[model samples]
Target chain A: MTVQLQRSATVAGPVRRVRRSKHRPIWEEQPTIAGYVGKTVALTLIVLAVLYPLYTIVLTSISTQATINAAGGLVTVPGEITFAAYRQILSGGIVTRATLVSIGITAVGTLLSTTVSVLCAYGLSRPNSFAHRPILFLLLATMFFGAGMIPTYLLVSHLGLIDSYWALILPTAVSAFNVLIVRNFFMGIDQAITDAARIDGAGEWRVLGQIVLPMSKAVTAVVALFYGVGYWNAFFNAMLYINDNSKWPLQLVLRSYVLQGVTLPGSGVGQVDVASGAVTGLPVKMAVVVMAIVPVLIVYPFVQRHFTKGVIFGAIKG
Target chain B: MSKQVADAAPARPAGTAQRGTADGGPGGRRRRPVTGTAHRRTSASVPVRKVSMWAQIKRDRSLLLMTVPVIVLLAVFAYVPMAGNIIAWQDYSPYVGIVDSPFVAWDNFERVFTNPLFLNAVKNTLLITAFQLVFFFPIPIALALLLNSVITPAIRTTIQSIVYLPHFFSWVIVVTVFQQIFGGASQLHRILAGHGVHFDLMTDPDTFLILITSQAVWKDAGWGIIIFLAALSTVDPALYEAAVVDGASRRRRTWHVTLPALRPVIILLLILRLGDALTVGFEQLILQRGAVGPGAAEVIDTYVYYQGVIAGDWSFAAAAGLVKGVVSMLLVLGANKLAHVFGEAGVYQRA
Candidate 1:
């Protein structure tokens, strides 16, 4: 890798140009040292801005009660660490229950959302399939116009879905934007292939299952990730629809404990850890935040590359 | 994305779906021979037939059937809720239901327009939107340009992975993360207070705009860059080569080549941003409203939720939300029309 280039930067523009050509093309000019330093510093700051908060959260969550107290709020430089917070929270407390609830919601919601979107997308994807234009319009219309918050809540309630998981899943499961993304991906597939399949006596179902979906796995994965993340991260809908604390997703739990400073209930962290003053609710709160985030972290890496394919639908991004 | 397309394109039409094809039933016999011409001619231009409506429905029944579930879900949820906006004019009582609720005509609207709380919400909503549009919107554009200049793919990808992580986190988590960093007893607060600079960022009303806008940027700005990067990817390298060969400097090349290529996408996004100007992070604002107080934090969404869902003043809240929705729609249309006037495609082109 190092064999291809010169490293003399102090020389004139021609010599500097030779060194830069390994990284940049010959047509591009050498970046000034000022620009180089500025870019490096800016990139470092941007990366740190994201990384530092995360590091502190992880550190603070794992730090011992003694360590947390010693280091004070948000332990940047780590000391003694413990899993007591993770154990206590994940050990059949309200946090554990909320985690389970979030898992269930994310799993079922992602599946349902992906299926409906894919089916509807493929259905409307055929270039001149009967009534496809009208159907596409029907789905697309939802993107630009909508009933606001109150009416949607009223509708869900009217459906008797209040405090139900269906309130979380069903109302938002098949968003039109998701449908459009999938549809756009489907449209990008060569029509010749689908047409050839049709001539080979394959039904639309077979074409979708056998041919189209397998080809468009990138968009499918991306759309699924979108819905899964949406479901996982959603708290507003739960707040509106669910009054029962038991139905609260990890987000609402995080909101109450971390954001609102509501002491955890059903083995409240504040209640048990009082005498020591070491295990104040900060670790518990941060642990819940971590739990809420971990799924997205786990799944995101796998789906990371598919997003460009997903948002290739300029309709959604723009 | 290029890698995926390359892999997927080569793998397609390989007779891989043996089970799927074997399981299919009665496709060749029942449907028209409209597709019969497809295999003979390598081209996709199939001859057309004038089929009756019934024939078309019968032919496409399975495709139509596939769309039914989505249609049902949208109808029951989206369209039904939209229809339920009637309650804005009605004195909607949950006990009475929409069927029995007394239609109060312009009563709710009249009250909503006059109510100081609603006005405060509207003002807050507009301020947040304007602030975000000015401050938050250009961040992704600039970042995309910077990241695109980053010649090393590994470095660029690593940065992207780190930044996009928070976009997947809930607003609750985003708020909590910010709290851990900037809360009353946060590291920054503690550090600052030790220097005799005591201030609580969470509760302060004055810097709430900056605080929330920064939050929005942190949450979304990374993910927002993806689309711009995609747009930038489509810009031909030859254009840059030509610009450089013609003695265009870096700044001039960017101005002439990069900015022009991004202009359509930027305009389209601007139109969309204006369309969604009123929706300035409902969940974000709602989570912080108690801390910052509603005076600074309450926007149309939170106001609607508070007055309707929280306070049980459904009609008044519905009226407020209805006005916001209508205004949002008008903004999208107006902005789209403006884009068309300037010879740019907005969300969609004119029919």
Candidate 2:
């Protein structure tokens, strides 16, 4: 957390100090007025490019059919605001069930993935270990070369995981990327503490459960957040394996809703505007997007401080 | 790497000759030249079996025991599936199971080579990946340099956070957001058309590639900057000070100092890009296929999904997947080897 603060403080303090010095050398000081104008213009353009589409999405979500037709489309603001879209989507059985299923899968999947990944990572990181090298190689090889989808699907189907909750959770329980990150983190812990545990005649399981697990809150939290997001965003596996509508995750449901644009019987978007294919004028799609993403968006900010460090493990040196 | 470690194992009897021949003293295994008395030896001796392989393993039992579950898991999942790659050569049918499926020799590979869709998928996958490398790769580095030079901290962090937001959005949400903003019912087109200036991007075929690439940059550019920024931070400030003392201009200093400093990271990231060259955002392409059509958007992963999953030809799909997997692995290994030739520690140490 302090890393972000410390970075800003260092960058700003030096630049500000150099700017105020009347006698400072031109080469060492900050840029001139023209340069400032150029940088400002460029930054403004970049910001607008990033934000405009998002602004349009939000604007369209609130606009009525009349407003959409009158404007021909929206850019900044809608002519009118309404909650009909939100009410309609929520009232619909598809969105509600999809939302609930997504929540259940994400919550349970994150817990299982994080726990298994951490235990496996911690186990592999121990020194002088029999299984360490071979297992690490196994994990790393999978990162480079997966067995592709056919075998994976066959494996899942063979296990009778088809149409079950396990179909989503089991195949994805321990991501090699997350395991590597957690293992690297465990290796960074002080050896003296682990040595003390050995001196106390503690077993490998006891030392892991009692000592290493307790102190790795940051990485543990980061890994859990990663798994949570992965589970929430997962669509392909569910799309392929899960035929049971009741077990459909949110992303798959959203895909069908957005792409097929076919509203189910109780979806409350009111009488098929079948002529247009899409609910053509309705904002239920935006509502679906919000429903799918709101959980992670809410959770991310709490753990945002670790985001940079957590994901950048192998990028720099690999 | 594990192979190297396995070869160097201390417990292996193969190392005993090297160990014994190198050192022949109290810690080594050779008769003492000066000690003639067996009684004296018995009083001072430590048991040789204590240093034996079985005893060494026992002493390190805690470490060995800790890694059991990891080994078991990997054996069951990763290694087992690798063994399943034998199916790539077969006419693998689910009804018959992996073992029972009759071997079809090179038929799958032959089918993949002859199929127009598979060839198009390869071309499309490479094209999109190359576009990403060309347009999307360097923006983050440029953005990081700009953000690094900002005089304000709060503004910098806020912008950074905002830019990183799209990365967390699912591809479905990202595509939906774009459709809402620019599709046939797009608000921007409506706003422009109201002023008698019609601008339509949703249906424009030529502009679709640029739109997809830009969307990719918007989503990933900020997140990607973390690596470049980490590299930038490690550059010595003294080098900049020296350049300043020599009257180097700001632009000159950045080029001569910062860019050179970031070269290793830039190269490393490029190598990674090469490794992931076969993967061109599968979900992104699949989601937008309706708008852009399969010609521009079809890639290897999507093609496999369509051919195998949608068309129900598991063997052909498996063949396409195998080709991609093999080509990508070769590309990475070759890149790693070249990196070593350039005097960098490539993915691992060379024996």
Candidate 3:
């Protein structure tokens, strides 16, 4: 019984053992006190390097105008805080319109891309399917070689997709990379089940819709989030294809406001706006940045758990 | 948890029976003949059997129907633009279109090679690529190594999640965040002003390249560590135990075991990065171009955009873009060959 426990402890490894005790592996000697202090300092500094900027951005966004002015731009310390910046941005205006536009684009784009990707990926996943090799070769070729920017722009313009939301969606509609990842996933499914469905007189569509997709919810969710975040954060396509300012997505608005320091017509109007002596003060600008980032932040935890699997499927397989 | 089990299921053929069939074990009776032929070959192992064209189409009719939209989308969006690259050799006018445009054989290529601005863009791109390869490449490996040493799963996951979060953010947000903290009128500047120290690092042209590369590292270093961590996890734990039994120290074990395990992944990523060297962040540089001026920020991608789309020098821009595309493809092939020379499977096996 003691031997079995020792074997189990070894099998669980140092990581698991660290939770219960100060277990050091045989390969590792216990470090001096100075070494421990040095490691703690290094880790703390690294964590601070990452978290400080993010904290400042969030803090600046919430602080009142008077507090910001007293703090001389961004308030590091907690003061009279308010959600006024969030209120203003969410209030019916350009920021609000851009947010809605981004949401719409993300939704529509994710649905279309995910549907098309599923079809392509499923088709490609079947080795015995018609023209599978040639079709796959064609898809793989796109991963290496691309039609450069000018000709692509010319094609979009020639097709009259310029100034349209379709320009954003269609130009980058199906990421061959995402398709390959999904294909890798589909290939991993138990062939027995799919074959069983086929033996039961189920057609290809039925097998895909009923058996394969139902089993692939995790990957499909992960892939959808990838597409959604992609569409939400895309500003270059908007910068290129979208000629009208009113049609700009949230990222583009964030770019113009925060990066270029362009104050929107209705972005600032409150107690803070008058007190900061700037049209779009630090808080409002940071608020727009936070707004642009919030969707991604909300979805990240769910998708974070799946990225290792998703990335391994794409990277290691290929 | 189900996904993990499902993912692991494909690796062990003997474990398939335990996973059970859709209609239960008795369902295998009907599936025996079908699975005999079909299940013999896993997806990536064997090429599909060659059936008659009509039979093949009939067998895969629904799948074919499903793939039609994707094929159409790629043809229209990807292939058609490749054909539109013909305009590189023409004096292209949007009004005249490709067919009617006056052919200017070799003129655009000659112009691109001769133009000082294009040359400058190439120089800047190569410099930025070199800087990133030197500074940005090893960071994630180091971070992964650090995280690997920490034997706490909860701390590792939390730190990893924090770092990886930035990768999901668009370049617009990244650049904006940097500008907010470090721009000319930024909070940093305001703080420095109170102390009577004038500072404006954002708009400084001399340091723009470093600034942009730092931004790239901040955004992607955490994400990059995932692959390295995956590689590290694959290293055998018994190797360390054997080394320990042989009286190897931690440093010696790391040197002998850990680094060697990471070598293949490192080389693979290096080859891929070399292939993508010319494309040094178009959106990141373009968004900041106004602040630091174009001379410092224009890489090949942004150069092509500015010369082609923004300035409307269609044929000339197309010429430069075609050169970049062709060179990039060649670089990829060349790097893959180099990887093979070093005994690593780069992107794909050579055919």
Candidate 4:
């Protein structure tokens, strides 16, 4: 029965195989005349639909203030290009401060969260431990029931975390879902390697740090990206917990820009205060959207491959 | 939603490991040394046979030690706050505190149940979730099927990368993107107005559900492609080859072979989605609330925000949140059981 399962796994699994399809003839594989045309049209439509809206955002962001307003909103082309909008949003103190705050929070928060996840996951994956069942049940129960938000807020407030960065970090630092994913990945490690380490007199932490993690880099990277992206995109907690404008993350700042329809340029605000007395501000607002998304957009292409790999390896039953 | 996603992993591991150990060690480890030398086994090998719970504890002592901080944190922040659900039955005041507050005993729940506004939010949530399960769920499967059929790795990877980019975008950006094209500044709006037409969907309460659902699709559909893609790889190539030899059309082969092969995955994903129906994306609703107002866009999470946190009525907010949490938990449990009853693997064991 075990041998049958092993055979099926190798035959069916996608990740294990590396193939060279040299046996197939390229010319014969080429689609017939009608099929070629259909494929081309379908591909073209898919590409256009995805690209056009993104292109419009880029086009508007680079458009000059005068041209954008003159066009009565963005059109096919910007007619002129200017970096003044970006300069205005960037140089202004609000976005600058918020960008730094978001960076600091994401960096520190990701490290802290990932570290705790690794520790707990390593602990939970052990065969039998004193704290295993109780700890596991406690965490599992958390997945079902939470103290709700008010009790959570009261708890944080009671701890004097209100108006502090800890408010953003502490409550959300260790995700139960993320922990399970990492733990699953750890469990996938060859038991022989861990047993060999144990025979060599290595402690649990040493075995994890020296053996398990190095082999588990792919999943760890995925978890870090997940945690990091979540931290960077998080603004609700900041909005709810922190009242001070100086400490607001970029999302909250962007939200305010959208709400007020204001474009504050060169003063550090991405969206100008059109309502406050600025003319031709839509370009600036477009620039703010561009500014808000660019960092994550840059990081995304690098991590996309590993993202699904990590999720699948963690999600499926072995 | 929280319970659904979280509970699935735990129940599987806990059940399998406990049963696997009791029956004998996992099959692989059991086959090794003991079979080679039954009576000649060293004391070290025999020690496992005498395994007491305390011995297991001693073996995993360091691991147990490391799990301490995690347990404490989850207990205090995650579980302890659950007790605050009592406030949902009371008139909770921050100044008066949870203890001294007047116990309204279901008044908040009664108000939520009776109010037309609250009922609308529930209706909207269910409607949007149902639409999501139908219109949105299958796109990714179709996409994964398409991608799997494509032999070109470069094209597949590039498309996947571009599509997945939206997953990381903040709800603020997603809503802003929608507003840019559909709001006052939208290219479509200008084009329509140029052609002597007018349409306002962004602020139109009637169309808000469609708008929100589309935004959700745009943001998450690519991410959903992952699971379907994973499941598709498990389909037997032999099945496709047999169909091809029988002169089957590509579409027919896919329909007969591929779709049937995806049954387990489809059922499993459906159960998961039902479990997550309550959590209809918190940040998205909050961002769009001002435009659509409470009439079309208010939800359980946003309601808690406005009533409890924003209004400083902590008790009422606590109650609303508790109801959502409990309802979501029950939904996942029921969904898992239903999946099992249908001869599918539920979140946990087969039975």
Classified by CAPRI criteria, candidate 4 counts as: acceptable
RMSD to native, candidate 3: 8.2
State the iRMSD of every prediction, in order shown: 3.0, 6.6, 4.1, 5.8
Q: Clashing pairs in model 1?
A: none
TM-score per model over all chains: 0.90, 0.84, 0.88, 0.85
- For candidate 1, write residues A36-68 as lDDT tens digits: 779889989999988888888888889987788
Query: What class would a CAPRI assessor give candidate 2's docking?
Result: acceptable
Best by DockQ: 1
> For residues A156-186, what per-residue lDDT tens digits would candidate 4 score against the true structure?
8878888898888888887888888888888
Give model 3's DockQ, 2 decimals. Answer: 0.43
lDDT of 1 at B224: 89
Give stretches of model 4 more than 4 Å off: A1-39, A259-279, B1-48, B52-55
Question: Judged by TM-score, which candidate is best?
Answer: 1
Worst-scoring 10-residue span by lDDT in model 3 chain B: B1-10
> Which 10 consecutive residues of model 1 chain B have the lowest summed lDDT?
B2-11
Task: Write the residue-wise lDDT of candidate 3 on B1-351 in tens digits.
Answer: 212222222222332223223322243223322223334445465444433333344345566667777887898889999999999999999999899999999999999999999999999999999999999999999889887876657877888888888888899888877876787656677778789987677888888877998899889988899999999989987798899899988789889999999998998898888878788888888898888887988878888899888899999999998898888888998998999988888888956
- Candidate 1 CAPRI classification by DockQ: medium
Q: Give me the chain B TM-score of candidate 2.
A: 0.80
Complex DockQ per candidate? 0.54, 0.30, 0.43, 0.33
Query: lDDT per residue, candidate 4, B260-336, as tens digits?
Result: 87788788788778877877888998888887888778877888788777888676677678778888889888987
Comparing 1 with 2 on lDDT, the higher-scoring candidate is: 1
lDDT of 4 at B349: 69
